[model samples]
Target chain A: MLVDRLNSTARRVPTWIVYAGLSLPAPWLFWQGLTGGLGVEPIKALEHEYGLLALQLLIAGLCVTPLRRFAGVNLLRFRRGLGLMAFFYLCCHLLVWLVLDVQILAQVWADILKRPYITVGMAGFLLLVPLALTSTDRAIRRMGMRWRQLHWLVYPAVLLGGLHFVMLRKGWQLEPLVYLGLVAILLLLRLAPRRKRVAAHA
Target chain B: GTALVGLAGAGEAQEALEPNGWDEITSYCNYYEFGTNKDDPSRYAGQLTTDPWSVTIDGLVERPGEYSFADIIAKMTIEERIYRFRCVEAWSMVVPWNGFELADLLDLAGVTSDARYVAFETAYRPEEMPGLRFPVIDWPYVEGLRLDEALHPLTIMATGIHGRPIPNQNGAPLRLVVPWKYGFKSIKSVVRITLTDKEPPTAWNKANPREYGFYSNVNPTVDHPRWSQASERRIGAGLFARREPTLMFNGYEAEVASLYEGMDLRANF
Candidate 1:
């Protein structure tokens, strides 16, 4: 079948390539930031870009199941890499906000408590931690079925990430709303009857 | 030190000790009509037509008429005024604006005695400003000032910046510059001015009243619903620079504080 052939082909492609490809934007952004290419408040520009990129990668990781089921294209081999990269970018985003934007460690806690967007974003990051740590093949072998259950946390994490973006914007914005809708639709796709067909195949 | 000395020589003290570079000022702008991103305005605002502009002066004014931009400039005595421009978003810049006081324009229009407020409106061209297509702000952005505030010597109707005609991204033809209030209060690319007895509706206030108050004075004490207003990052400061403590009325309190005397700033803010 085409699905078997595609899965074999996707597996041959080294997953490290995904990491190398996704990592390109960081150096470019750093260069732009250092050279005054980022217009007023470079740190803010950098932080925003990192956060948005993380959200995009998380969405891409979520697309793997829907794509395999609906289109018979298997990118499951690269899914773990995509998820880890997303977590990496999210860490960069959080660190930038903490070290550069806020600076004061004491105020960071105050901000997390006071600001709804920060609270939501921090919650999202915390939820993603277990998924990222358990992304290894060894963890999958050890945890077995329990591993999949824990990794399901990606749904709430991605949703909270989208909600964090929406809450941070100044007013009613179209882009953030669209992102939230996309995340909702991706999550809804997983709850469909096709899940039973996939489980039976497994 | 050199930059301050040059400004001091020009008799423009009380300017930011380190004024923003001309490139920084021009490149970074928050003209929401063009877009929300700071870079969006500089990229798109060039398409905006500023020539052959006319401002409709109406309401409680005796000499109500559409005054051409050329005629207005010809009639007014223009001079350079260095002022601190503070955004409600807790960022600021010291800009050298060239224009006449808003009081001069009010005088020319012959504001009626009953008029208590001066309302201003920005040009709303959907074709030029793609942001207008979205409901980011009410089209034809409206802002207002109290009559006394309008008449304040520091309140200017700016036409130019950095010793040249104001760039399109920075409100090309004519823009109000209420130095003591948050930047949004200084409505840009003005097309209409109305003197009224009642307080005029402002764009930000109409959008989110809970967050953006009608009287968006630069008070460090009163915070925005989501963010602290106690400190602001100076625009030209490099990436590693720290935020400086924001001052009351953005450091113009000595000049404009009495205008709000006996009023509750917390409530108004």
Candidate 2:
């Protein structure tokens, strides 16, 4: 009975509501950053927070299949919302690093080209560009079967995102390693041999 | 060389205020021997046993033997000094340090006429300092200063902070506090004081010679290859607070600048 409710009326939960709810944190984070709530290094703190939020949403977006398969709860309708929210956070993260942290265009360019961590992070951002562009309903319909294949880009992009976090830090740390581990496990679960891939059709 | 000679006169003195509270001093640190994280020292330095510590005074000194921490403290006259501590990372704090001038200790050791530099070595217990397990830096951290610089009244071997025995996290038993140069030059948890004829290789300079130079004086004009050195963020200042313009020799030029004399700061840096 609960499954029926979730599939029918629950699935009809407005996309605008999800968008507005997720957007609420952006202004709060900006206010904190501007008002001295971010501690000693506010720019660094804000940059880190934004990047982490992006990674968290991306990981959450990847969990839709496992949720449906194991828990018998299909929340596929919110997958696009999660993905768009992740992209929005990623843009904010990159903007803060570029405009606020680095400030100099030459230095920003040098960082992307010279630093291995920045190079990988830029690659992840590049991969997401096409996925975000093709996320619209009209584009998905027009692209048809090709859409699914193109969206597989998210896998490599998410892997790079996790690797970026790990490499950006100075020395070996537990938090970054845990994030990398979660990303790996989620990806491996998707690649595990399954009969017919029911979620692909659904 | 001409420019160096022309700039022989020292800059004017500047005022520096009291340091951040004890909580900030105890919590934040960059002790690579413990770990790279700012809070690692506070979290892990408790494992170090400093009560029974001893410092070996060797090299060109007359007294070349291990002296217990207790004995060293007993022999020295303690005084409180408020000094501005500048880190290479472009952050600063003014801390109240309780210690005697290092010149008094050198006098006690009777430095040999051949001694031109004062080399310092930090404690290296791999088991206690987990960061030592990694090659983050060459173990047993080393730093050095010119003889004149070491003998300066400003150079102190700190025993305590804020009138309390220095916490294990803040280099408990003993540490050098050379207010003019960057923080790393003031080596922490000192275990050895070697009076040497030649300039000693510092831990950071040895690790990355290009980035970290031997005479790491705070010069705002000469920017680090990675970042600007023109300004510094004051610790305990609110996050959004504007970074203050960095001072040459960290505003201690009035006292220490003449020591460099005609030497090129860029080359020596």
Tens digits of per-residue lDDT for model 1, B1-269: 43334334335345434567678788888888888788889999999999889999999999999999999999999998888888887778888889998988888799999999989999989888988878866677899999998987778899988788999999989899988788989888999999999999998999889888878999999888677788888886766868788888877776677789999999998
What CAPRI-style quality would you assign to candidate 2?
Answer: acceptable
Q: What DockQ, on C-alphas, does every prediction get?
A: 0.58, 0.24
Q: Name the 10 consecutive residues with the lowest summed lDDT in model 2 chain A.
A: A167-176
Compared with the true structure, model 2 gives a TM-score of 0.75
TM-score of each prediction: 0.93, 0.75
Interface RMSD of 1: 1.4
Per-prediction interface RMSD? 1.4, 4.1
Tell the DockQ for candidate 2: 0.24
Report chain A TM-scores, every model: 0.92, 0.92
TM-score of chain A of 2: 0.92
Best by lDDT: 1
